[model samples]
Target chain A: MTNNILYSIKDLSKSFSQSNKKVTALRNVTLDINRGDFISIQGPTGGGKSTLLQMLGGLEKPTSGMISLDQDDLEKLGEAKLTNVRAKKVGFIFQNYNLIPTLTALENVQIALVPLGIKKLESERRALAALESVALSDRANHFPSELSGGQQQRVAIARALVKNPEVILADEPTGNLDEETRDQIIDLLVNLNKESGITIMLVTHDSNVAKRANKNLHISNGVVTTRS
Target chain B: MFFTYLRREISKRKRQTLLVSVALGTSIGLIIVVNAASAGIGDAQKTVLSGLYGIGTDISVTKSIQPTQGGRGFNFGPENADSSGASTLNQTRLTVPIFSGTFDGQTLKQIKSTKGVSRIAATLKLNQIIFKGSIAGTASNPTTPQDPNARPRGFGGGNFNIDMTSIEGVDTSLTNVGPLSGVNIDKGRIFQASDANSQNVLADSTYALAQKIDVGSTVSVGSGTFTVVGIVSSASSSPETSANLYIPLAQAQTLSSNPDLVTNIYVAADSSSNTDSVQKAIEALLPDSTVSSQADLAKNLSGSLSSASSLVNALSKWLSIFVLLVAFLIAILFTSSGVTRRIREFGTLKAIGWKTNRIVRQIMGESLVTSFFGAIIGLAIGVVGIFVVNTIAPTLSASVVSPGRFGGAAPGGPGGPGVPGFQPPAGGFTGRGTGFGRAAENATTLKLHIGMNVSTLILGVLIAILGGLIAGAYGSWKASRLSPAVALRSVA
Candidate 1:
């Protein structure tokens, strides 16, 4: 109930239909994400870590139970409202960087502010500022294919920062990066979290990154167990 | 943001864009080319009609040959007697009598007085004896061909030639109007008012050239020795109407012994738009005459040639549909494939708070750009196709038959191209053609006029754009429906 709590998950569950078979991706997942908390959801492949992050970001609806983001029930909200919630309150960082292949790094960053209906000039200014913060101001004009993996991830971080959302939902944010690039990207997310007081929910298979989080939630077969 | 992304994506996939555009463009181009040819054929039809009816002349009025039912021996009425028959006109039928189906002064005055009537020219068409190797200008009797194998004026009349040829005696003043007026004078000047009473005549260029006659030459036609004052190039005149000699109407009426008469009257309406009204007025005044407009002339010229026109029209219509469908399908398929390839890209966009409509709009923008390029390429292909048609087959002649007409076509020479070899039909519309040796008319040489007009060009471009957008919209809507979760989960 406190103003610091970003999300409260209770009896959260999700299932998917795979070729006529019911696949339970998550079950009875409960967790609390405090404001500015750097939380990592660690699990193996198909262990529902990504689904949990999707639920937290209001990108996907839970089939059962409740997900309250910023004190509003995500499942109770309409599609457009949930989308707006995602737009105004949550930003995503994907493993593949998920930069629109066509857009340059700066345009990709500008995209985050597009749904907010900000003026073009202001959007571009904010986008550039975000790129500068990610230390890729020089690579702002480079397309995704034009930049190295580390640089693309950094650009992706700038895109997330452009919206200045309260929650950054990172889904295996460093999954496809080399070791050094991964560490650098992890540092960037952690820095964003520590410096901006931005709530960070990181999904990864690496226990090491999870261990670095303020709170680590481990998932095995749809169950979440917190690690001290 | 959407547009910026669209621009970047389209340019980034320039090769794909070009390939897709070319595919759609070629289809659109084919449609343009086919329609242009069809348009050319339509123009050719109009040209032949204009030439026959007189350039700018809209309606042609000629007295019908139908004979009145009751006629005693040696007594004749227009409805009961043939011009070639041995009969004399009675007092009551004096306006249109025997031995001459030509209109009289009263009928001419009536026609000229009609509303919307601008100008009228009356011509008395006749057949006179051909004076071969002899300058005998007497209508007393027929002359023998001194050289029978001498090339009969532009026909397959080899050796077995007809003893008589056509002569048109037109009003000297009215020669500035009518079918005889618009033709080009290849040599010398047309008939002057002074020449109406004087001994002067105009000759068809085809006949003059074949006969080796020119201006200042004297030739004996009928019983008159007249100086050939001009050589005329005629596109409309079949050998039947392309009179070997053009004399004063008065002189021709005298020679034919049907004074103050004419067989056909050409009427020029004030404007093309008034032709129908003028034609109706002429028909009302001269109730017994057959009044035909330029449209009627073209319609009556239907034959195997019109079959070709019909084929081209049908082909253009169906091919247009085919090309449009193909264009739509290509855009749809291309957009769908593109969406599939960029699934994650779209997912990212959706995850980035882009509304479904926004994504759809970007897809449409890309599709439109691709189609715009296609339209340009298609127009180019169309123009090139038209040029090729003009070069490959500049002039095409297809024989046509009209009512009450069979003609012999004048041979093509240096006078002009695309002149239909006019041969009179084998038989007139009415079985009476056998009564007077009517010549068979050959087809008019049709020159293709294929060019893109602004309206058609605009319409074609519009179709291409609409087609591309419609298909793109469909594909985009499908893309919009793609759940970001589903797309992100799918590796491919």
Candidate 2:
């Protein structure tokens, strides 16, 4: 039923002008994502996989189309409302980990709770819990530069999951890691989706990472196709 | 969270923080120093004006007159000759200076009642000339021509010498409002109320020193001897006084044969704000008299002190503004560049659901913290600068010319005199004019002492805060306009 659908897309399209030429990144794509679904979008470089992931996170707007997360329409909402949706309902992870170099691991996790206006002690307690979930509790006081790539990614994951959002969108979350570290990060995300019933949409080039998700979509040159 | 973030961010970039604070601190310090120096220069100018105008006397009124023809003369007759056909004549004449005109005593009463006049004092300025010499007895010399201009046959064989002294008659009861107000008693005592009608005088220290006179000594004026009650020095440390000798107003009027009249009136206004109005009122009251206020008097000043005043007012003022502008510009540029270097960081913040306003606030907080440190450094620098200025105490010299036209006097001598029983000397002699037509010049030297006030400190802090706000606004605007999507895409 429609009540179980977490995201509904209709005729979504995006384009950008590069060197005075319009290049289509996403075009007339329609899809539905049910609650608690783990979906992976695999595509080559310059494809629409990351664009779709960003749209789902409300980080980018569609040139023409309508997309809704629950009852709120991402296209119709103002910038402030979109920001609020991102704060309350969505979390994002980048390929570079993107942890603030000036802040420690615990502070990076606590930063997510800042927009929620939680009390300082409670934010700290919850941030420590999130670090424990990622097995990064011992490194809470370590800065990003002091942490290994896999450890920093885990801290990034702790930051994303600390807010208890409805969904997490990751753009190449494990692209910078080696074979063993990439598997660890992917296994952590899988456990978060399975144990917490939180929906996830990830864009990756690794077929193995895509194979772990329950649903997989492939795209190239702005067109999407289902992979059974 | 904001404070923690700001603290970490500033601590991380210690070099940039120090650079901005030092630049702004230099500007604010310069502003304080310039302002204090200007105050010092203003006091110096007031000192020069007060040399003649006197302190606490806000307005002055005077009138100028041409000297009388054939300037006052001294002659001898048969009665002035001795039995040896030799005569010694010694006489002292007290008269108003050739350039001053006296106003009626009734005008003083009217000025005292003027709307803004808080106090009034009148002075009669006079010049005393002493003529002491011998004249050949001409009673038996009938061969001498009766024509006063005729050249005689034989010389009189006598020498004459003349001396001039400036004298002022002041109201002993109200010496606090006129020229006497600017004098400090160096010896003896000031005039008491009982000395108002007596033949007592206050001699200038410089004049008394040069004349080898002291307190309790008697000085002759108009053939009358007056005891010197006190010896006074110029309050501004000037070389001369407004007058050499100060006597009671009554005695001066009587001696000068100008009874119940005053040549100059010194006025005190109720307040400094009322000075212009009082001057206008007095000007209207006596249309023919010249009324001058302190502001008007400052413009009439010249010499090195005036140049210093101009340098402080024009050059230092502009220099302060220019340095402040440059400092502010440097702050803005540094803030903008710091923000530019952190574009990806801000984009990551926004992507993590940090609102635009929150990020803007973080940037602004960092700038304000830096600016606070700048204000502290500026205050320290300003205090040091003021201390140095006061310690050095540079001296400046100022000169002001009298505000009236000089009157010329005609030369008088025995050559043109035809007194009975007096014969013209051979190779007739002539008395030269006193050459008093030149404008009166007053010069004073004073050491400058720069002082700091509470308001100047407040201004320095306010300036630092303003610079922070300006720089923060520009930086925050740049931070706020960042599109998170585009920013992340470029970095990726």
TM-score of each: 0.74, 0.87
Interface RMSD of 2: 0.8
What CA RMSD would candidate 2 show? 4.8
lDDT of 1 at A191: 86
| Candidate that scores best on TM-score | 2
The per-prediction CA RMSD against the true structure, in angstroms, equals: 10.0, 4.8
Lowest lDDT sum, 10 consecutive residues, model 2 chain A, at: A48-57
Q: Please name the candidate that would achieve the greatest DockQ relative to the true structure.
A: 2
Flag clash pairs in model 2. Answer: none
- Every candidate's lDDT: 0.73, 0.84
- Summarize candidate 1's per-residue lDDT along B13-131 as a digit string, tens digits: 99879877887788777888778778777777766665555676778776545433333111112233233322122221111222235678898898889989898988887755321
Question: What is candidate 1's CA lDDT for residue B51?
Answer: 53
Candidate 1 on A1-228: residue-level lDDT in tens? 488888888999999898999999899887778999998888777888888888887778999999999888998998788778878888988888888888889999998898899999999999999999989999889888999988998898898889989899988888888888888888888888889999998988886677778988888889899887
